[model samples]
Target chain A: MSHVGYGCLMAVDREHVLRSAAALLTRRATATMDEVAKAAGISRATLHRQFAGRDALVRALEELGIQECEAALGAARLDDGTAREAVRRLVGEFESAAGLLGFLYTENQLFEGEEQNAGWSRIDARIAALFRRGQESGEFRIDLTPAWLTEALYGLFASGAWAVSEGRVAAKDFQYMIVELLLGGALRREES
Target chain B: MSHVGYGCLMAVDREHVLRSAAALLTRRATATMDEVAKAAGISRATLHRQFAGRDALVRALEELGIQECEAALGAARLDDGTAREAVRRLVGEFESAAGLLGFLYTENQLFEGEEQNAGWSRIDARIAALFRRGQESGEFRIDLTPAWLTEALYGLFASGAWAVSEGRVAAKDFQYMIVELLLGGALRREES
Candidate 1:
């Protein structure tokens, strides 16, 4: 194979390992590095070479999650026509990252006094900006601040992920369930 | 003091220990039983006498969480009025248990294959019923399932609790933040 093709293959392999680690860790937060490699179908030596250790692997996962969120935000086009439609698109785009996001959400609770991944703040600001746009456009209620709405979005994503995992809700319904309730709420609209 | 008064004092002490454990564990899930006792300002021996072991202590915490949830549901008078009003009251009442709820929320994830504390399913049913009532009353949208709404409530509560703890959102806004978002969504009403 050509050098460029081999490099592409390596990138694909790295992505596979990261995704496998994310899936396994999401199911069992305390899984060891050896177990992570086993789950990823790679040798422990290769796993170590790929990721120096558990901390490095976790950091890589964090990076991957951030990239996914950034990509999803970009694809959703938060600056598009209507903030509501933009949010719908965002949730739809974000659906794929829910499992990885859930793992990171729980992992973050352990960072009490420690410095958190800076990537999180960037993602938060982006999401919050979407809510702010909605508020500015009079598309969203001002009573709920952008910050709180952003936090709520994270919470609901984690919740929806868990619910889907436990068979409490269908996988197919995940995006619709979150988007409708989030954008429309549980309340039925009455005619003015 | 009378023997009954002395017993009452012991009960209060036990309750205090449980609450302290919940608070500490919410902040640090790995807190030791000894640390829990210290946080409660009691001896480890006394803590052991009250709760046999970590499992026993966690079980006691689960019971406390359940009782608080049931109490909140009762105090909210869920069946007496409009589902919207009932949910507001329920969120108001449940606000106090957010710390314990948050701790249990994380703790349960570790249960993996273990039998979940039955108390949780009972609470789930009760909360789901409230959502069902809302839908039946035309006060809530029918698109979202009662089960998903129930799960969303859990997510929002945990999110609000964390946001409050981190000072991301004001402590006083916890109820409003959850209630307004859960009921009204981020979108502003166009006419009504």
Candidate 2:
């Protein structure tokens, strides 16, 4: 294989390891570096070489999350569809990343008043802008602000994911639960 | 007061102590027993006397959560009002117990196959019945199930509470944010 192709393959492998570690750590936030390494199928030495320590590894995971989110936004094609449809596609995209989002959601709370990672804010802005565009185009309701809607979406997604994991709700219903609640409101609409 | 009154007061105090500890531990799950005692302003001995250990404490909290949820269901008067109004009241009651709810929201995941406390099922039944009532009355849309709506409400409440706590969203807007998003949705209304 060409050098560039080999490098790309290596980067993909690294990301796979990092994401596995992230999934494990998210469920068990206090997991040791050794356990994370084991979960990723990498030796301790290699894990240390890849990430200097736990904090460095988490930072890398955060970057990975940001990249995935950007990719989801692109894939959802927010610009092409109605805001409501866009949100549905976005929620579906976000379903896979729910665990990481849950971790970051709590982690941000631990250090109140500290600056949030800039990547998160950037992603938030992009999501918020989508909602704003929907409102402007008369596709969404005007009562709630784009900011609160964005936060609510994040919270509901985390809650729905956790609920499904706990068997309190069905796993297959995650997308339907979030989208229906967000778009249709829980109240029964009057039939014409 | 009479001896019986004094006994009643002591029982109330015990309940208070347990709740304060649960609130503290919900935010800091790994906090030591001493920390929990200090948080409740009770002696370590008293705390231990009430709850034999961390496991005991969590179990008590789980029971307390179940009871509180039942109380909320009663207080919300789910049968008397329209499902929309009932949900609004339900969300209002839940807002006050947001911390405990958030804690249970995560804790329930740990007991994978164990039977959940029966109180949750009862509460779910009440909420779901209200939604069904609304549907029959031509007040709610038929597409979404009452079960999903119930779960969605729980998710949105947790998310809204966390957002308010982190200062990402305002406390004053809690009710408005949740109700609007859950009821009216993000789509702009025709009249708006």
> Cα lDDT of all candidates, in order?
0.89, 0.78
Docking class of 1: medium
Model 2 docking category: acceptable
lDDT tens readout by residue for model 1, A31-112:
8888999998988999998888998899899999999999999999999989999999999999999988988987888867
What lDDT score goes with residue B109 in model 2? 57
Candidate 2, residue B56: the lDDT equals 85
Model 2 per-residue lDDT tens digits across residues B71-188: 8888988887677788789778777777787777766656645887787788789888988888888778777777777777777777777777667789988888887787777765
Clashing pairs in 1: none
lDDT of 2 by residue, A78-115 (tens): 88778888899998988888878877676555545567
* Model 1 alpha-carbon drift over 4 Å, by segment: A1-12, B1-12
